[model samples]
Target: MQNETTKIALLVAIATLIFLLVPVFLILYIRSYNRHKKNHFLEKQNMQQKFESEMLQTRVEVQDQTMQSIATELHDNVGQLLSLTTLTLNSVNVNDEEKARKKIDNSLALVNKSIKELRELAKLLHGEQLVESGIGHAIDQEINWLNKAGTYELKVNNHLVDLQITSPDKDLIILRLLQEIINNIIKHAQAKQIHIDTYLEKNKLHLKVADNGIGFDPNEMKMKKSGMGLNSIYKRIEMINGKLVLNSAPGEGTSISIEIPYP
Candidate 1:
């Protein structure tokens, strides 16, 4: 009887050990599985980010190529055709002066229209990829457009010629800044003089757009009211992690200074 009791006790002890050990082993196994799963998820996220970045880069490249092609077509094909048509009309051998004059007038009108369209297309093309070429090239292109368009005397004093601003967001920042400034001048400034200056200091890039026009106080917006031009300019500068400083008051002219970190 004593031997049988002893054997029974040992059997019960072995059974309890197996039961506890099984659950502990299962718990450890589950923890290891979860860790592996989490690592895999992180790796997938990393790969996805890389893929998105590559796709964005490719899209930009394609857009730039397309803009270049359009510019070429406008300048070479459309412009040449318009010029040829005008020349042909001018050289028409007509004895009747009235008929010749009418034809000449029509040809002149058509030529002017075509030139306007080509110029607009050229500006669009130039703006699209100006940053890739550099800030100086971009400013030069804008000056060229302004000179040809006769909108205003767009002067630029680009001190930092080799300024390395390679941010993907640089183009948008420059375009919005310039467009807002020019549009404001056209609509409200009523001034013939406009100047743009660029300088860099303490790893920050600074730009100034000044015009000899009717200006308003920046602090007295509630008193004088801020127009769409001023509001849009401020919003755009803010979007690019930059700040704007307005140095103007009523009858003092407007000067806008923008500062952004150099990338």
Candidate 2:
């Protein structure tokens, strides 16, 4: 009887230990998961903050560029128009009825022309309202601007033209992404050729830009955290629930692919 009692007590102790250990293990697991979740959220927030700051700086630069063009227009075009209108008004005479009427009409016409030109300048003051027609035309416009340089041999296959859906919000962001990529190429790529392809497949929009440029190791960029250019791209991609793939190596050139959900 004594031996049987000892065995039974030993088994009970073993069972109690396992029961307590199961809950302990479960609590530790929950704590670990919660920590990971918190860290992810914090990282996302930091990235967003950085992206917003970068965007602010970019907007300021755009405004500065725009102001330069506006100043030129004011001097060369609008100023001349306004000056002519003033001369016409000053020459108006009441002595001769027909002459007075003609001068007044010319002045009115000149003033109206000036108003129209000023209105256009005002619109441009908004820092170039791009993609106004559609995403397709917008990309074409960017391509045309790049072509004017006569620097890169370009090959473009853009299927986004036939796409009927419109996502104005995403369109602007995507356009900016392309601009940033192109800017990087111009500043750093030393690229001789560029190939751009945008299309729709499997309910996702794909945009690819490849350049035969002097490439750098992407891993090194990440390790160095090379400024906000790449980080902004990644953060904006995340915000739109998009994906980006970047491939590059020393002397191998670079290719970037972006996929985003449609409207």
Candidate 3:
């Protein structure tokens, strides 16, 4: 009788211990899962931040190099040629009717064309005005100057919506993104006509730049990393808390629309 009582007590104690241990184990498991999730999210954020920083640095470096090359061209080559042409025209005698008149006219025309090209190049090289003049005017000026070359056509539908909403950081991102997109079209699109439309809707800025260029399959482009320009533009947009949509197909040309919400 005593042995039976002892056995019953022992079994009860064992069962109670298992019940307690089960809950403790479950609590520990839940804690571990939560910790893992937190770590994963933090890691993802870190990676995104790092990517944005690197991209911005790379873009600035490339822009600096381009500006340097353009400056050298404008100061050393074009400026020297124009000066020499002016000197030659001035030295010619006006009394020689036919020869002097013909040479002066030709020189004058060439100098004017050179000056126009140089001005366009200077505009393209300038990056500081993005923050100074605000985004709308800066972008409009760029489009107008770009059109002067007649290589690309630009059409702006909604023009009077220049909201003072861009931060210095955001401005650079926007400018760089636009430059990349335009450069891409010039390089790969073989695009003749480009259209740009900007509008403000519901406190969000929307910009659309489209080209009637030779388009390709997005899937193939992604697979081969062929659309570096598109990739750069989209990534910059993402960095700035914006969303980008790319629409295009082979022979259909391409259009990219970016929307950014302002706080």
Which predicted model would earn the best TM-score?
3
Ranking of predictions according to TM-score = 3, 2, 1
lDDT of 2 by residue, 38-142 (tens): 999999999878767765655565556457656866887789988998888888888988998998998888889889878766755643355444567667756
Which residue pairs in candidate 1 collide? none
Model 2 CA deviation exceeding 4 Å by range: 1-132
Per-model C-alpha RMSD: 9.9, 7.2, 5.4
lDDT, model 2, position 190: 92
Residue 193 lDDT (model 3)? 89
Q: Considering only N, C-alpha and C atoms within 3 Å, which residue pairs clash in candidate 3?
A: none
Candidate 3, residues 161-258: lDDT per residue as tens digits?
36666555665566566667777787789898899887778978778999999987887788776455566666667766899888889999999898
The local lDDT score (0 to 100) that residue 118 gets in candidate 2 is 82
Query: How far out, in Å, is residue 7 in model 2?
Result: 35
RMSD of 3: 5.4
